[model samples]
Target: MDHKRDKEAVLHLYNKILPPLAEKIYQNLTEVTPLFDDFHLEKVVDTWTKDRNTTSEKEISLENGNVQQMGLRLRLNGFQAAGAQTFDLSKDLVFLLEYSTYTVGPDKNTRWLEKPYLESWTSKEMEETASRWCEEIIDEITQKLQTL
Candidate 1:
C-alpha cells in the first residue's frame, strides 16, 4: 500500500486546521485580562512549526502516516509601567507556550503512549476527526492562555 497518499491526506488535514488554530490563540491573547493595573499585553508572536518542540533531532519528520508532529509556538509579552494610562509595545515576557498535536492513536488521551500509524480512514472521516481534536485543543489552549 502506498503510504504517500495517507501522508498527503494527513498533511492536508493539518494544513487546513493550523491557520485557524493560530488565529484563535491570538484572538484569545488579545482578550486577556491584565494581572496588574499597569500590565499590558503588548505583543503576540505566533508561528506554525512542523518541528516537534519536545524532541531533539526528530524535531521535524513525518515517520509513517501517523507519527507526525506539528505545533504553534506562542510568545506573549507585556510590561508594567509606573502609572501608564495606556499600554504600548514593551518586552516583559509574560508567557511562552507551544501547543502541539500528535497523530498517533485513535483515542485522544492515549495518543501519545500508543505507537503511531495512520488509520486507513477516508478523507472525510479524517477531516472530521482532526477537526474535532483541533477544536478540543484550541479550547484548552485558549483557556490556558487567558488564565495566564
Candidate 2:
C-alpha cells in the first residue's frame, strides 16, 4: 500500500462509488416532491488538508428562499505508514449534516438555526457506514421536511 496505490483506491471510491450513490439519493429525494424540489447533488473537487494531502468530498443540499434548508457532506481522508519492508495505508470517511431552520427575533434580527451531526468511519467500514448513514439521514430529513 504505497502512496500511489492508496491514491488509486481513493480515486476509485471518489469517481466510481459516490457519484451513482448520490444520484440514487437525489432521485429518491425528488420522488418526495415539493420537499426536495431544490435538492441537489454536487461533486466537490479535490481539497487540500491541513497537512497538504488531498481529500475528496461530495455534498447534497436542499435550499429554500435564500438559505440552506438542509445539507450533507461526505469527505474522505487518507493516511499511509511504512514498516521496514511493508506499507500500510488506510482512509476515513467523514459524514456531516446540518439540520436547521431560520428564526426572526423580537428585535427583528434574523438567525439561522442548525443542529449539526458528524460521523467518521474507517476504510474497512466504509460501505456499511455510508449506506446506513445516508439512508438514516434521508429518512430523517424527509420526515422533517414534511412538517415544514
Candidate 3:
C-alpha cells in the first residue's frame, strides 16, 4: 500500500466526517442553532476553534532527513449549560476528549507533517480537523443542556 496515499485519505476522511457530525448534533438537538448568530457561528465560533490548539514539534533528527512529528492537545474546562434550571457543567460532566492522528506507513518517510515529507498529511491540519469535530460535539451537548 502507498503510505502517502493512505495519509492523504485519512485526512480527507476526517474533513468529511467532522462537518456532518456537527450538523447531526445541531439538527437533532434543535435548540443550539440560536447560540450564535449565523455570522458568529460561521466566522467567530469556527475560526476561534481553529485557534484553540496547535501542533507542537516533538523531535527532529539531524543524522538522517527526518522532519519529526507533533500533535495538538486541548481541554475545555468549567463549561456550564442551562437545563430546565440551567445545567451546570462540572468535572464529571467534563467530557474528556483527546484527539490524535498519526502517520502510518513504512520507513521514517511515512511521517505526518514531516518536512520534505513523503506523506501528504500535516499534523497541524489533522489537529485542527479533530478540534473542529470536538467543538461540534460540545455544541450539541451545550444545546441539550440548555433545553433540559
Which number leads on TM-score?
2
| Per-model CA lDDT versus the true structure | 0.36, 0.32, 0.32
Model 3 spans with C-alpha error above 4 angstroms: 1-10, 31-84, 88-148
lDDT of 1 by residue, 37-130 (tens): 3422222222334334345443232333233334343323343334533332222211112122234322323342221223333455445544
Poorest 10 consecutive residues by lDDT, candidate 2: 61-70
**What alpha-carbon RMSD in Å does predicted model 3 have with respect to the real structure?**
12.6
- Residue-wise lDDT of candidate 2 within 1-148, one digit each (tens)? 1222233333443465456545554554443323221333454422322212323232321211111121234321221213222211211223222122122111123232211112222343434434554565556544544544
Q: For candidate 3, write residues 54-138 as lDDT tens digits.
A: 3534232222212222222222333333434433221111111113323322122433222222334344554544445445556
For candidate 1, the per-residue lDDT at 83 reads: 50
Candidate 1 worst ten-residue window by lDDT: 89-98
Q: List the residue pairs that clash in candidate 3.
A: 81-87, 82-86, 82-87, 83-86, 83-87, 83-148, 84-148
Pitting candidate 1 against candidate 2, the one with the higher TM-score is: 2
Query: C-alpha displacement of 58 in model 1, angstroms?
Result: 12
Best candidate, lDDT-wise? 1
Report model 1's TM-score to 2 decimal places: 0.32
